[model samples]
Target: MRITTLAAAAAFAFAGSLALAAEPAQAIRQNLLALQPDMPIESIAESPVAGLYQVQLAGGRQLYASADGQFLLHGYLYQVQNGQAVNLTEQAQSKAIARQIEAIDRKDMVVFAPAEAKTHITVFTDTDCGYCQKLHSEVPELNRQGIEVRYLAFPRQGLGSHGAKTLASVWCAKDRQAAMNLAKARKDVPAASCDSPIAGQYQLGQMIGVQGTPAIVLADGQVIPGYQPAAQLAELALRAGK
Candidate 1:
């Protein structure tokens, strides 16, 4: 009886919204919550698609909803332009990711760059990750290719784990770049702690969909999971810049 009553009340609210959808955005939000009480909304904005609204949900999920809140779309939205298909959805996501990554100041990150790097990549790394160590080894090569490599601490083992403590130590070190090298080489770094962005960076990685160590974010905000050869990575960075 409880379940039936709740369902009927939600149905009634949705029916009212459908009849008075003059405020599309509000109607969408209200009806969506009525239908799915667990889903949380972050923002709603007008979309390029006529009569549809873009809904950004908590945890970085996105979707398109009908003006009347009668339907929702989960797939990518694209348009044909100049004989080519442009993925509007992907473009938006990339721009948003780029903005979030750019919000982190370089001074807080361990940076390796040539004097005249044309592009940069932000990597979420962990000292205990074997592939992350391998990736660090290729930083010099990437720098030679005119691609800057910036490191953000992401302990794959989660906060308070051994990996997180090691990362915090690296961030807290006087010579962060040197400390990073030592830690990546499986050497002990003097335990230290101060105002550091280790936790914040790790949280940012989680918000942006980082699943593992050595996750790379290109200049355009496109995420490349896993390791790539220096030559290949440089090529990709250049392409993303263009």
Candidate 2:
């Protein structure tokens, strides 16, 4: 009887490993769909921490889950031994954002680029943000100093809200650069609609932990939240490329 019990335990262990081994991608998607059907699952992969699977959403929101999908986790996960956040989710999410950003056409952005273009900086911006306006005000200086600034709409509100409408209007404008200037100057642009990529970009911002307007993304996928002056931003962008 004891021998039979040992064999049964071995079988159970083998089955458990099989489940875990299959999890990095498919299992994560399955669980996310199970949890929130409307949430678009973009990618799933293994994390450095054992028993955790990283789930990336279409809008750039990321999360970690147990191999079997029994538990769902949001927010930063930490490693206690060294007193540092594991940030496994952030690492994976950043990679995913890099891929998405690469696929985006340069024309989709409201670009303020230097004539001599040294570095490219992508900012998730909202017109209502004071700091975002301050950042926008530095566009000429940024361009003159040789840093290219690209803008992606990230209305503080989610899709279908007033903020989203405002961003959509700017995106749908005949002259987006002019619309941006008007919006930044606190003038309302006529409500316009288009099948813009603003929705997807906003989603990406959330997944990448962008909490506010003027959130800057460097070439290396390190996110700098909030605004920085033109010269300071230029220096950071240079260092990021290196």
Candidate 3:
């Protein structure tokens, strides 16, 4: 009886390892592409859940699937630890976002900073967004509080919007900072064309979970949706930097 039990356990272990192996990644990718040919996949790897796989799409959004690629889950994954529901998926996303933010060049963003900034926050802004304009008005005070503000264009109204056009103009302007200020104040910036990062940044905002303007991203990849007061946002940045 004991010998038979040990043999059965060995068989189960082998099956489990096989179920978690890397061979399923190609199948998952191929099958997913068949469903949505335009979907861009960044990576596929085994998830924390046994026999499940994590699929990271271009721009940081994710989904999960069974090892065989026959089943899919498009929601957050949680782990119950010590009676607490820990958001494992969100934690992974936060790390990924931090890495993505780190990869971006500073020159691509419109920046307002103190000579010696204590900490900085990235804001995804739409020129036509009321809340975004409100936040911009307080940038000077925030800079005074040692909080640098970096702006990335996100025309919430889609790529063809007037906001997107204005943002492109700002990017093309000889004086980007001044153009941005005029835009936030609802003034017209000279229409110009150049190789712009607006489209890319707008897409990036979508990938990073920015559904609206004035989205504040801290250094640690924590996103504060909508507008935040200068003092409060500066405090948050200081903490994240530490």
Best by lDDT: 3
Give the clash count for each candidate.
Answer: 0, 4, 0
How well does each candidate superpose onto the true structure, as a TM-score? 0.83, 0.70, 0.84
Q: Write the per-residue lDDT of candidate 1 for residues 7-46, one digit (tens) a residue.
A: 9999999999765654888888898999899776877777
Model 3: per-residue Cα lDDT over 1-242, one tens digit each: 99999999999999998765757998898889999999878899989988899999876678999878999999999999999999888877777887888788988989998978998899999999999999999999988988899999999889998999999999899999999999999999999999999999988898888998899989888889999888888888999888
The Cα RMSD of model 2 versus the native structure comes to: 6.7
**Candidate models: Cα lDDT each:** 0.88, 0.80, 0.89
lDDT score, candidate 1: 0.88
On TM-score, who's better, 1 or 3? 3
Clash count in backbone of candidate 1: 0
Q: Sort by TM-score, best first: what order?
A: 3, 1, 2
Could you tell me how far off, in angstroms, the CA of residue 230 lies in candidate 1 after the best superposition?
Answer: 0.5
Among all windows of 10 consecutive residues in model 3, the one with the lowest summed lDDT is: 17-26
Query: Cα RMSD (Å) per model?
Result: 9.8, 6.7, 5.5
